[model samples]
Target: MSDRRLDDSEMATWLPTIRFVQLLPQVLDRTLKAETGLKHSHYAILVTLAGQGDRAIPMTELAQIAGLSRSRLSHAIDSLEERGWVTRTSCSSDRRTLTAALTEAGRELLRTAAPVHVAQIRALILDPLTDAEREQLGAILAKLTPGVAAAL
Candidate 1:
């Protein structure tokens, strides 16, 4: 790694972005837990599964999409399974592969949780952004995603 430190200009930009990254999740988790008894990760898993045409997704792919480690996802799946919100099964084509599917209960929970989650998201993040700023933010984040993922 280079020894060069972040300059004042870079620090000014980076500090708030890092702070937002740290705080946003806490805010989201708090709202979801209070309203629905679901953590943000659980809610994300449900939303991802719901988007997958209600079909089972392989555990590995699900972890990637959710930005979780395999072990963390497995543990979350276990909790969700106990709650009857998710199910895991061995893949028919590849017995070594496991798949996760959202249950009817999960769908119901998501339907109820989504509006409240969305409103919080708007209040915390989107409501402050002008249309052009929102578009710019999207573009900037899109450019960052690949590097962040690779770093992870």
Candidate 2:
């Protein structure tokens, strides 16, 4: 079959995949916001920094990891700084380099919010799938992530 030769059934099957790619984030964002007072972007930033532990990352690297533009990341960081959930430090090795680290308050916030986030995930996502189905979905998403990154 040629690349353009997708028939009705193939097209129909793929439509949901495309739609899911578009809608999942917004749905998740709503749930996150309602439950934890955290936007999806803020949650992502906090989780990323928390995952990094005591080792701080440069702002640019943090932006890339969180899949945000530099400016957006800067704004989010500024907000977090204001909330005292993060601290920005000048790198000793390179005075020009700045790093963002999760503060004790940030860790506490994440710990407090973790259950709400988990419940949101369960209600909006995992509970909708069987164990096997969840595994398959995870595999599919993992496969797609690299292609999406490549395009970006």
Candidate 3:
């Protein structure tokens, strides 16, 4: 624990940032679940896989990109596999190395799910911020992401 405590000025900035970080996932998860029967983490995993085009990502890399523990990602992958949305396979030469890819069903589900998720993001987050504020937030996050990723 640190010896220093947040002062009023610091808390003023930190409180809402913390709240946004904490609550945003819950809000997004609820909306996604209601509209698409998918949670935000699962959606994120899908998006990450989709973003890579035809490539099948190694499970370790997927876990890092999806910001999930290896076990959590394993469970999520199983759930996704059960829904016919993803596939996991082992390398022929190296059976211990596994990779994951999105199936056609996953792509089709994203076609329906993306709009709802994007709309909610705009409504709850982006639409409220001015262009300048959005720029600043983007820059701030970009600067902080390296340190945060290193910690993870």
The C-alpha lDDT values of all candidates are 0.95, 0.87, 0.94
Colliding residue pairs in candidate 2: none
- Residue pairs with backbone overlap in model 3: none
C-alpha lDDT (0 to 100) for residue 27 of candidate 2: 80
Please write out the lDDT profile of model 1 over residues 17-134, one tens digit for every residue.
Answer: 9999999999999999999999999999999999997689999999999999999999999999999999999999999999999999999999999999999989988999999999
Kindly report which residue stretches of model 3 are placed more than 4 angstroms away from their true locations once superposed: none
Give candidate 1 misplaced runs (Cα > 4 Å).
none
Q: Show the lowest summed lDDT stretch of 10 residues, model 3.
A: 91-100
Candidate 2 per-residue lDDT over residues 90-129, each given as its tens digit: 9889989889999999898888778878887898789999
lDDT of 2 at 121: 83
